[model samples]
Target: MRIRSLTARVLILATLWSALALVTIAVAISALYRQGVERGFNNLLRAQLYNVVNSVSIGDSDSLTGSPALGDLRFSQPATGWYWLVEPLGNYATAPLASASLGVANLAVPDVEATPFDQNYERYYEMTDDVANHIRVAETEVVLDDQGRAARFRVSGNLQVVEDEIAFFTSRLYAALAVVGIGGLIVNGLAILYGLKPLDRARRALERIRRGEAERIEGDFPSEVQPLANEINALIDSNRRIVERARMQVGNLAHSLKTPIAVLLNEARTLEKNQAEVIATQAEAMQAQVSSYLNRARIAAQRDSVLARTEAQPVMERLARVMRKLNADILFELDVAPDLTFAMEQQDVEEVVGNLLENASRFARTKVVTKAVMTARDDEPTDGRRGWIEVVVEDDGPGLAPDQIGEALKRGRRLDESKPGTGLGLSIVKEISGEYQGSFGLSRAGIGGLRAQLILPAVTKDTA
Candidate 1:
C-alpha cells in the first residue's frame, strides 16, 4: 500500500494507539509487581531485626551481643549478602556484632538521631557494598532489658533478589506486549481491507460506466458511500437527457433552414436568363452550405453519446452488397474480421463506411478494396478506449499529390470539375471521424491509388 493512501493512514494511526495502550498496561503491571516485591522483602527484614533485638540483653560488660538470623542459610555464609548487626548507641559501653556473611565488611548504619522512626519504631534505608550488590537495611533503636542503656539493631538483605525479579518480569512483559501489538496490527489491517471492499466495487462500477458497458452505477454500497453513487447515476441520466434534447432541437433547426433554400432554388428558374443563372448558383451554394453545416452539427451531437455497438462484418457486408449494385462495372473486394464491432451508432458507421467505399468505387479504374480490422491505437488512452476499428478503402484509379489530397478534404473542393458529384464526401468523413475522437487520413495504397483510413472506437462482446 502507498504510504499516503487511506488504508495506510488508518493502519498507522491504529498501530500507534495500540502500541501506546499496550505500553501503558505493561508499565502499570510492572509497577504493581515491584511494589509487592518491596513490601514482602521489607517484612522479612523487619522479622530479622526483631529477632536480633530480642536476642540481646544487658550483658555482664554492658555490650550488645546477639545470635540472630532470618532462618536463611545465606546468613551463615561469608559475603553471601545477608546479615544482621546490633551496636550500642550514643557511646554506650558496648561494641557492634554482626552475622558471619558480613565478613570483614562494615555494615554502615543510618544515623538514628537524624532519621525519624516509622509507626513500628523501625526505619529503613538502602546501601551498596564494595561488591556492587545493592543491600536493603532495616534499623531500629531499642533499650535492652529494663535498663536505660539503648542499642541500635539492623537487618541487611541483598536488594539483588528484588532487582533480578523485576528485570526478568520486565523482559517477559515487553515480549508479551510486542506479540500483542503485532497481533492487533494484523487484525486492524484485515478489518480495514474488508471494510473498504465496497469502495473498490464502486470504483470498478465507475470504470464500467465510463466504458459504456453500464449506463449508470449499480451495486450495494456502504451507507456512507451510497449517496455518492446515487448522485453519479443522477448526473449520467441528466447528461443523456440534455444531449437528446439538443439533438432534437438541432434536427428541427436543420429542417427549418433547408425548406427555405429549396424554395429559393425552385423560384429562381422563373426569372430572366442572366439573373436566373446568378440566383440559381447562389441558391444551390446556400443549400449545400446548409446541408453541410447541419450534418456536422448532428455528428458533433452524437459523437460522444453512449451508443450501441454495431457489428463491423455485417456493416461492411451490407455496404459491399449495395456498392456492387451501384458500381456494377467495377470489381469490389471486402476483407473484414468476424465478430469485430464498432462502439458507435449503426447509422453513423454506415455513413462513414458508405462514403469511403462509394468514393473509392467512383474513382477506381478496375478494382476497389474495402478492409476492416480491429487494432490497438496508441493515440487513445489504455482505459477501455485503446481498442479501435480501422477501415481502409483503396482503389486502382489515379491518385492526387499529398498537397492536393489535404485540400481535397475541404468542403466542396472538387479537384476535377468533370466529376459528376459535389466533393463533400471526404470532408464529411474527416469531420465526423474527428467528432468521435477518431482519426481520418489519406495515404498511398499498395494498389497504386489513394488510400482512405478511418479509425473509430471498437467494442467487443466482453467489454460491451
Candidate 2:
C-alpha cells in the first residue's frame, strides 16, 4: 500500500536514497581495495624475482647455478604456484635454473606485443599454470656478467590467493556499510517525526475549534506553520462575519415585511364580507411563507457558528414543564442526561424541540414521551464533531402510515384538516436539522403513536 502520511513518505525516501548511496560507496571501495591488494601482490612477486636474479651467477663451465632461498615454504613445494626461474638470453647455451616448485614445467613468457615491459625493464602478468592454478608472474632482464650476457628472471605467485583476500574484504565492507545505512535511516525517521510535531498540534487545535470546544486555534507553532494557523483563524472570523451579516439582513427583511403584512390584514377587515375572507386567507398564507423562510435563514446562519452550544437536559426539562402546564390532560415524560449537550445554539434547540413537543402534545391522547441522549455516530463527520445528540418525542395518539409520514413533513402539509395548525411544524424541524447537518425521521413508536427523531451534532467533553 502507498503511504499517506508525510512522515512515512519522508522516511521511505530517505531509506531508498541511503541504500543507493551506500551501495555505490561499497562498490567503489571494493574496487579500490582490489587494486591495492593486486599492487602489493605484484610487489611481493617482484621482490622474489630480484632475489632469484642475485642468487644465480656464471660458474666455471659458464652455466647459471645457485640455490635461491626466498624464505617462503611454498617455494620449496612442487607445483605450489610459487616459483622462480633464471635462464640465459640470446642463445648463450647456459642451462636454466628453477625453483623446486617448478617441477620441470616452465613459466611461459608473455608476448612483448601483448604485455610490454615498463620503463624499468620489468613485465608483470597473470596466467594459469600446468595444474590449472591461477598465478601472477613478474619478469625482468638483467646482465649477469661483464661479457653482456643477459638472463631473464621471473617469479610466480598464486593469483587466486589475492582474489580470495579481496572477496573477504569486500564482504566485510558491505556488512559495515549496511549497518551504517540502517542507522542513518533510523535517525532520519526520528528527526522527521520530531520536526513535524508542530503540524500535528495545529491539526488538533483546528479539531477543537470544529468541535465547538474552542473558538480558534490555540498554542504556539513553528514559524513555518504559524502563517497557516493565522490564515485559518482569519477564515473562521470572516465566516462568522458573513453569517452574522446574513442573519441581520434576514431579521431586517422579516421586520420590514411584518408591518406591511399586518396593514394588509387590517385593510382586509374593512372590505366586503366575501372580499375580506379572500384577502385574509391570502394574507395569512403570505405571513406563513415569510415566517417559514425567515426561520430557515436564521437557522442557516447559526448552524455554522463554532460557539453555539446548548445543554439538552435543561432545554428538555424546561420544555417538558411548559408542555405539562399547557396540556394538563396529558402526562409528559422527560428522559435526558444533564451532561448531554449539543453543538447548537440554545434558541435553535428550543425551536426544534419546542416544535416537536408541541406537535406531540396536540396529537397525544394522554401521554407524551421525550428522550435525549448522546449517541456515537456510525460515520465520521467532516467538521470533527465526534458524536450526535438524538432527541425523540413520541405521542400515544393516532399515527400516520409509512406513505403519510413523508407527506406530513412537507411544508404547509397538514394530514388532518381538523387540527388547528399551519402545518409548518415538522417541515421546519426537518429544515433546521438539515441546516445543522443533522437528520430528522418519523417512525412508529412502541406506544403505537407517531415518533419523531432529531439527531444533531453533540459537544464532546474536553479531556485535555
Candidate 3:
C-alpha cells in the first residue's frame, strides 16, 4: 500500500518498533534477573547450614553439649519463618521432616579438625523423610578418646527466610518494569513527533507550489532537509529560464523561414507556361517542407512551455487575440469545451490548433472553433500506463472522405490544392508529436466537420 502521509506513517512505525524492542529486552532481563537472585540466595543459605551442624556435639554416654557454641550461624532467639536443628544418636529429630532423607546417607562424618574450639564445615541440602521438605544439613564429630569415650556433633538450619527475600526482590522488579516501559514509550514518542516537524512544512510548501501561490519552497525547516528543498527550488528556476529562452529562439527561427518562402513564390510567378508549371510545383513542395521544419523546431523549443504547463486556454486566447488584429472582419472563436491543457509544448499546441484555426478563419463562414482534450495519446499502447494530452482543431468548412483523410496527413499533401498553405503544417505537428512520444491523425469531429487531432505523451519537467 502507498503511504499517504509521510510524516504520520514514519512516526507511527518508528514508535511501534521501538516499543516492541523495549518489551523484548525487558522480558529477557526479567528472566535472567530472577534466576540470578535465586542462585545467590541459595549459596549463602547453604553455607550457614554447614556451620550450624558442625557446632553440635554428643558424648559416648549420650550426653549432649558443645565445647564451644557455633557463632552467628543460627538465630539467637526463636524466629517465626526459620529455625535450626540438630540430631546426634537421638531417638527423635525435633525438626518436622517428611522423611530422614540425608544427602550422603551412608558416608561417615570425618573428625579431621585439629583445633577443638575452631569450626570448619562443608555445606549441603537434602529432603528429610518426615515432611519430605528441602532442608540444608551440616555435621561434625567428637570423641572422648582420652578417657575411653566417643562423641558426635550435627547441626542444620532452615532456608525459608533466604528464599522469601529473593522472592520479594523479584516481585518489585515486575512493578518497576511496568512503570519504566510506559514512561520510556511516552518520552520516545514525543521526541519522534517533534523531530518530524520539518516534514510537515515541506508538504504544505509543495501544495502551495502546485497552486502557483508560491514559486519555490522557502520555509524554516530542519537542517538535514533544508538542502533538498533548496536544490529543488533551484532546479525549477533554471528550467523556467531555459524554456523562456527556447521560445525566443523558436520565434527567430520561424521568421527566418518566411523570407525564403516569399522568394520561392516570386520566382515561380516570372516563369513561362511549361517552366512555370514545373517550378511552381517544386516551389510549393519546397515551401511546405520548410514550413514543416520550422514548425517542429518551434515545438521542440516550447516543449517546456512555462515548465510543461502549456494549457491550451491561454495559448488559444493569445491566438484569438492575434487573429482579431490580423483580419478585423473575420469571426474566430476557440471552442475548447473543457479547457484543460494537453501536456505538450506551447508551440506544438499552438501550431496544430493555430494552423487549423487559421484555415477555418480563412475558409469558414467567419466561424472557427478549436476543440481540445487530455486523454491517453494513441501512440501510447493500450498496455501502457501513461497519461497523454489530445488537442483537436475542427472546422465546419468542407469535410473530407476516408481516402482524403489519409492524403491530408501526407508529408507534402494539401486538402484544397489551391488553398494558401505550406502543406507542411500538419506533418510538422506529426513530427513534433513523434519526437515527444505521441501520435497525430485526421478525422471527423462530433460536429460532422473536419477534425485534426494530436495525441501526445504528457511532457514532464525532466523530459521536456
Which predicted model would earn the best TM-score? Answer: 2
Tell me the spans in candidate 3 whose CA falls farther than 4 Å from its real position: 1-32, 39-62, 65-83, 89-120, 126-216, 237-288, 301-306, 317-342, 359-398, 456-464
* Candidate number of the best lDDT: 2
Task: Give the alpha carbon lDDT tens digit for every residue of 1-464 in model 2.
Answer: 97899988898889889988998999899999999999999999988888888898988889898989999999989878998888899968867998888978987887998999999999998899999999989999999889988899999999888989998998899889988998898889889989999999998997687656788888899899999999999988987887789778988998999999999999999999999988987888789888778877877776766666787887789999999899999999998966887888787889899999999988899999998887766654554545688899999999889999999999888899888777888988998888888899999988979999999988775522
lDDT of 3 by residue, 1-464 (tens): 77787666866776677668767866777668667865665555455444544544444444554433335433443332123444333342232211122322332333345323234433344434233434444444334234434333444445564567656765676567667767766776677777877877886776566434577888887789999899878877886777667667766766886687678777878888788777777877776676566656656665543345456677878988898788677666665535464566555667766676676565554455665555654345644655576667666666778898777777767778677766666666677777666777777765556777767655332222
Q: Relative to the unseen true structure, what is the C-alpha lDDT of residue 289 in candidate 2, on a scale of 0 to 100?
A: 82
**How far in Å is the alpha carbon of 242 misplaced in model 2?**
1.4
TM-score, predicted candidate 1 vs. hidden true structure: 0.81
- Candidate that beats the other on TM-score, 1 or 3, i.e. the better one: 1
User: Each model's TM-score?
Assistant: 0.81, 0.86, 0.64
Which residue segments of model 2 deviate by more than 4 Å?
A: 69-71, 258-287, 302-311, 336-343, 373-390, 401-407, 417-419, 455-464
| lDDT of candidates 1 onward, in order | 0.82, 0.87, 0.59
Q: For residue 247, what is the lDDT in candidate 3?
A: 62
